[model samples]
Target chain A: QQQVKQSPQSLIVQKGGIPIINCAYENTAFDYFPWYQQFPGKGPALLIAIRPDVSEKKEGRFTISFNKSAKQFSLHIMDSQPGDSATYFCAARSGTGNQFYFGTGTSLTVIP
Target chain B: NAGVTQTPKFRILKIGQSMTLQCTQDMNHNYMYWYRQDPGMGLKLIYYSVGAGITDKGEVPNGYNVSRSTTEDFPLRLELAAPSQTSVYFCASSYGNSYEQYFGPGTRLTVT
Candidate 1:
């Protein structure tokens, strides 16, 4: 099993449009969820994250909507701009802290 | 703070060659990790260290080795480089197991 699965391997959105990426996990033991954004020639950076106990988290134009009962989570980018075009990944960690599982990743393109 | 730093931004290795990818973090994080990112696949953990002198294998540790001699440095070694091992490597560190990880700029390696 993938452990964590992300949908829309690729996405395209116009400037000022909203781009949403969804992810699901099969492991209920997972308690922490994180999203990473990576640009060409660089490493991934933490965009946003959420815990199983929370329903949503918003940081600037980025938001994370989490549903523990459904074992799913999604990232929403409001006012998507060309600068937001990059590869995004969703990852999960079980228990307190050992290793984490990652999704396949989604490549997003924002057109001007 | 320099966050996390990785050396050898790019390298090309011949089959059977050995090389070391160096990583250092100024954050003094207790948790350090080495990950490899392939084209379509997401980042895969190669090895991790919870503290100095302690290291553990991750999902894809087959051809790699790691050492954590101090709280700030975690180096990954490739004993025998292979074409299959060609990919981008990332180093990350977290203050604790429950905190967000900070990543390095990443090292791109190509084995031929």
Candidate 2:
């Protein structure tokens, strides 16, 4: 039960719209959850993360809403622009392990 | 500082050929990891290192090897390249057990 399943393999949103991507994990032992953003040919970068204790976190136009009871977390981009188009990955890790389990990833397209 | 750096951003190998993918971190992170990303598969951990002289295999470690002689360097070796080994390799580093990780640009290898 070490999998993190992400939904909507791909998504398309108009400019200035709000785009949301969801992820659910099967392992409740996972205490740390993080989201990463990757461009076409670049490495994934740490976008924002939330701990089990926090229900939500906001950084700029990016926000992460986490639910411990539901074993789910989501990333929301407010006023998404064309530049925001990229692949997003959700990951989880247990408190005792150095390994991070990643989701299949979602390809997002923000059209102008 | 170059958080995490990988060499030979791209490579092509013939069957049975061997090569080493070099990784280094200037942040002096205690944790270093190697991951492979395939289309729609997200990132799969191949190996990880907690500190100098310490290394361990991850989910997919077959046909691969790793060495951690220094805290700043963690290299992955492919003794015999195969078609299945063709994927984008990424190196990441973290200061502690925290979920936040810094990733390199990634090295794309194609085995034919």
Candidate 3:
């Protein structure tokens, strides 16, 4: 069973457009949600994160919108650029455990 | 600080072959994890360690083994290679159970 599920295996957007990637989880125990970005042949890097206590968190052009009750979270990239083209993964960590569950990932392509 | 480092960016193995994937972190993190990413399937946790000498299995642990003898090093071993194990492997480390994780450049392994 996949603990975390993500939609849209791939996405394409033009420069300056907004790209949204969504994820859902069934475990209510998950309290921390994070998004990672990976380029070809490189490791995934932390892009942004959010705590379920807050409805949303934003850093620069990246923002995370979290709904605790809905058990869902989404990442939105504002003014998306060609450089933002990469694979994005959403992960959740339980408050009571050390293991993290990751989503299948969404490959976003920004066209110039 | 080099964050995290993984050895042998790529490898190829024949059926029944064995190999060890090395992971090291200079951040002195106590939590470490190993994950495998397959095409369009996302990333799955294979094994994780909370601290030295304390290891646990994650979502996918079959055919894979891990050991953490020190705060900075975690190694994953494959006793026998199989086609199903052909995927990109990643190592990650964090300060605590729910803290931000740092990931290493993945190791791409192929089995014939």
lDDT tens string, model 2, A1-112?
A: 3399997799999999999999998788888899999999999999999998899999999999998999999999999999999999999986676889999999999999
Location of the lowest summed lDDT over 10 successive residues in candidate 2 chain B: B93-102
True contacts kept of 1: 0.67
Candidate with the greatest lDDT versus the true structure: 2
DockQ of 3: 0.77
Give the alpha carbon lDDT tens digit for every residue of A1-112 in model 3.
Answer: 8899998799999999999999999988887898999999988888988888999999999999988888889999999999999999999987765888889999999999
DockQ for the candidate 1 complex? 0.75
Q: What does the lDDT read for residue A106 in candidate 2?
A: 96
Better of 1 and 3 by DockQ: 3
Q: State which docking tier applies to candidate 1.
A: medium
Q: List the TM values for chain B, per candidate.
A: 0.98, 0.99, 0.98
Give the winner by DockQ: 2 or 3.
2
**Interface RMSD, one decimal, each candidate:** 1.0, 0.7, 1.2
Per-residue lDDT over B1-112 for candidate 1, one digit per residue giving the tens place of the 0 to 100 score: 7889999999999999999999999987999999999987899989999999999998999999999999989999999899999999999998889648888999999999
Q: What is the TM-score of chain A alone in each candidate?
A: 0.97, 0.96, 0.97
Candidate 2 per-residue lDDT, tens place, B1-112, comes to 8789999899999999999999999998999999999998999999999999999988899999999999999999999899999999999999988688999999999999
DockQ score of each predicted structure, in the order shown:
0.75, 0.85, 0.77
Query: What fraction of correct interface contacts does each candidate retain?
Result: 0.67, 0.80, 0.73
Sort the predicted structures by lDDT, highest score first. 2, 1, 3
Off by over 4 Å in 3: none
